[model samples]
Target: MKSEELTGNLHYQIFGLRSLYNLPDSVVKKFELHYASLPDSTIAKDTLLSVIINRKLKNSPYIFLRKKDGEVVTIYMENSQYQQFTKFKYKELIDNKQEVCIKLKAEKLMGRYYKCISVTSVKIKKGQTLGKQGKFLLYEYE
Candidate 1:
């Protein structure tokens, strides 16, 4: 299995959202102060924006199979279950191709206090090369 991370301007949204998702307890506490002033409906969202992209991996650390409504499932018994769920969700659209490219974006409209915005995914076509944010690395078997 070979895996790599995508880090570029296009992925900034992913990076930002993940940063918010993994915020420290102390930071979250501070945000809670601001959160208190928000309306009741704003607090009910619970910070989860949405599932932008969902897909599986054929040769990487995770595997892909569709769930309800063709949603990708990462919990392939053959693959490790400890994989961390993150902001970007890449698809497994190619089986014989070398690699795939995934693009994502998010949008959140609450009050001025909070927002989580993002896009979805796109698999790189065969013979196509990586775009600005695409990266390739050898993934080690876990």
Candidate 2:
């Protein structure tokens, strides 16, 4: 699909969440968690926050939660229109227990030029993309 199509799909997902959960756009767009806890707990919280933020930046279709047991949990936001597109890819990776390669493309306006970019065949690590260029890291399931 085209980049615009992908972006539209993501926006649809975001708006769907707002409608389904009755959440304000601000809440859906970003989240923060504060804890009053121990050192290890703080570390875990920080790790989880980083993961979520990275995923958001990458335009990944799923939200991840890292449990105290160190297991990463995938939560497909039900309202996301792109959930089906992402779920299938994730399932394939999980079923095979193998890494899936991905490509990322982005465009930026630099002065008078529109610079189009591409990064290809990046690896997935810890359920997130490695070496992909973007704010959010993409992931293949499993």
Candidate 3:
């Protein structure tokens, strides 16, 4: 939906929900516990805030979330949209888990970029690529 279609507060709430999804499962549960304690007015500040994590697509990085009424959403906000957050940096990859984890700062600007760590344990066809460059990082395997 276009930014003009939703009220500012409504838009924030939806985007907030998307941000919450980036958090680890434990943190999201804590947020739910706290949110549940707020007044009815605050809890229902935006109807679209009622969303839950849905499945991720196989072999793709996209993550899907669904609302109570079955409306689905993606955690695909652009890097420029949330200045408060950072993207993963190439330097940080060495510290991240072998599978991967998330940081506000990301490695590549577009498509996917993989700075491979273990070349011997796993084999990729010498010329094959695991990821691409893109405007955003859809999801990181932690």
Which model scores highest in lDDT? Answer: 2
- Please write out the lDDT profile of model 3 over residues 1-142, one tens digit for every residue: 1111110000011122234534667886887688678777664432334322122111122222232343333334333332222333222432342212122222221122111111112111212112334565534422
How well does each candidate superpose onto the true structure, as a TM-score?
0.26, 0.21, 0.25
Q: Estimate, for each residue in 1-142, the C-alpha lDDT of model 1 and write its tens digit.
A: 2222221111111112222233467786776566566676764343422221111111223222222242332222122231322322333212343343443222222221111122234343463222224354322112
- Model 2 steric clash total: 2
Worst 10 residues of 3 by lDDT: 4-13
By TM-score, the better pick of 2 and 3 is 3
Best by TM-score: 1
RMSD of 1: 13.7
User: Roughly what TM-score does model 3 have, to 2 decimal places?
Assistant: 0.25
Scored by lDDT, model 2 comes in at 0.32
Where model 1 places Cα greater than 4 Å from the true spot, the runs are: 1-14, 40-142
